[model samples]
Target: MKKTIAGVDIPDGVMAQAATDLIRGTESELMFHHALRAFLFAALTGYRENLTFDAQLLYVGAMFHNVGLNAKYERSPYRFEVDGANAARDFLRRHGVAEREIEEVWVGIALHTTPGIPEHLSALVALISAGVQMDVRGARYDEFTAHQRDEIVQAYPRESGFKKKLIEAYAHGMEHRPETTFGTVNADVLDRWDPNYRRLNFCGLVLGSDWPN
Candidate 1:
């Protein structure tokens, strides 16, 4: 049966499990935790208004954005972004997702690592994913230090009550951007040895713990 969270129906259990497995292979509990956190955050923020196609697409995209990490780590290691996207595309296809949705998913996975994509749901997911990555690394984006956040605010500044609603919805999640930590490490040190360690570490911050369960 499909699992629903915050009103989004996740269609395939097998694919979900596959995604879980891929994230788990990172061996970083923190990475897994923050990844899920980002997904939840995306779902909550993206669905604030009517669930448009773009928003729905982003919700799914955020869920499986990092599904390629393990495979990427095994392959080139440094190019986890590319590897993870390819792996996610394959996994999505294997799980019987439609071609068009798969393409959207691919685009989301690919651009999540890079900035300057279009300002659609994929781009939004990419930005939020980046924020989540920052969280995993024990970093925070305050009003002053958040250049990207400032850009986003400028691009979508509150001009009207409706815009305020939208920004409020986004802010509800974005406001919880993680803070720095020096006392404790959440994931195993061995997991940090991968060539994609930096990326995975950031991801770990976003994902938190409680993944692959």
Candidate 2:
């Protein structure tokens, strides 16, 4: 049966079900629930903002946004966000979804970790970012009513010490390719967890470039 939470109907189509199965099999219980909560929160934000979005696409984006954190991608060269985005792209393509919608999901997942950029891109991207921030950092917490918040959390409870676990997940995913964290918030996770992590300075890179000044 399809479940509705916070006035949003969870997408239960074959693609949606397949996406749920993929994430359920790939991620931990905590991460799987986090993805589900992210979807619910994104849908709720779409309603409050009067923004129309494809629920299925948003669900897929949310489900695959963190899949890069899995052990399989530990050696991936790209940023974990891009890895997740590419995974979504491949999945959507195999499902015969349109190219435009696939790109929308790609951008949404790719920029999910980028704080300010995704919100300005598109309704799909903005909602994904908003949902992630709201779930992880309590951004826009007051926008949702107390009852709404309680209901969503009740449906997908945040595990104990979710913040720490999430940080560890980020660290574990990106630790191998520390260079990918440059110029994004993901760097902060490595700095905290990996003692060998040395953050690249943007200004230093700019001035140290091989250009005749």
Candidate 3:
């Protein structure tokens, strides 16, 4: 039984289907689940906010924000923002979404991983999605090579301190090392992983818009 959070019901079946679609031919189910959880977290958080645009569009944007992470990572170094945006455009069009709605979703997906996106519901989704990625990676920083950790630190230097703190909190929560559980996906993953890591990281990055001194 999967759990619900912020009105987003994430069941095992839904996650499994998403994972199957995401991983496709990959062996990294853990990565797939992490990305899926991040998307759910983003959608839930974005929906809980006050937005000027249609909430359903935000939901759709969040659901497909990272749709291209795996495929893009295979070709290049985690260029999910660009690839994901393109993928979302096609996916949304296929599902009969309007052109305007598709554009909003594409904007959300493109800016989700990168900084400098305007402050709006779509931007919120992107911010939350990055936070989700940080949560998953922070917990298992040791699992990642030194180079990978350095890349994350470089990519998000503005939030490095807060991210370090959040990672520390995550480490404390997981007793210093978090392990991934296979064959199942649940909200506990978010509870244990904690989106607050992303939340704080986003705050730090957004508030400190000026380059790190």
TM-score of each: 0.48, 0.97, 0.45
Which digits, one per residue and each the tens of the lDDT, describe model 2 over residues 5-112?
Answer: 989899999999999999999899999999999989999999998998999999999999998889999779999999899999999999999999999999999999
lDDT of 2 at 63: 96
In model 3, the worst 10-residue window by lDDT is: 177-186
Model 1: per-residue lDDT, tens digit, 14-131?
5666666765665344345545555544444445433345543454455555444443244343333445567667877877888877776676666654434523555454544544
Span of ten consecutive residues with least summed lDDT in model 2: 113-122
lDDT of 3 by residue, 13-130 (tens): 4333543464444423333444444544444434444434443454444455545444334443333455567866776676677787677767766655443443445554454444
What does the lDDT read for residue 176 in candidate 3? 20
- Candidate 1 local accuracy as lDDT? 0.46
Instruction: Give the Å error, residue 153, model 1.
Output: 24
RMSD in Å for model 2: 0.9
Collision pairs in model 2:
none
Specify the highest-TM-score model's number: 2
Better of 1 and 2 by lDDT: 2
lDDT top scorer: 2
| Residue pairs with backbone atoms closer than 3 Å in model 3 (clashes) | 131-198
**Candidate 3 backbone clash number:** 1
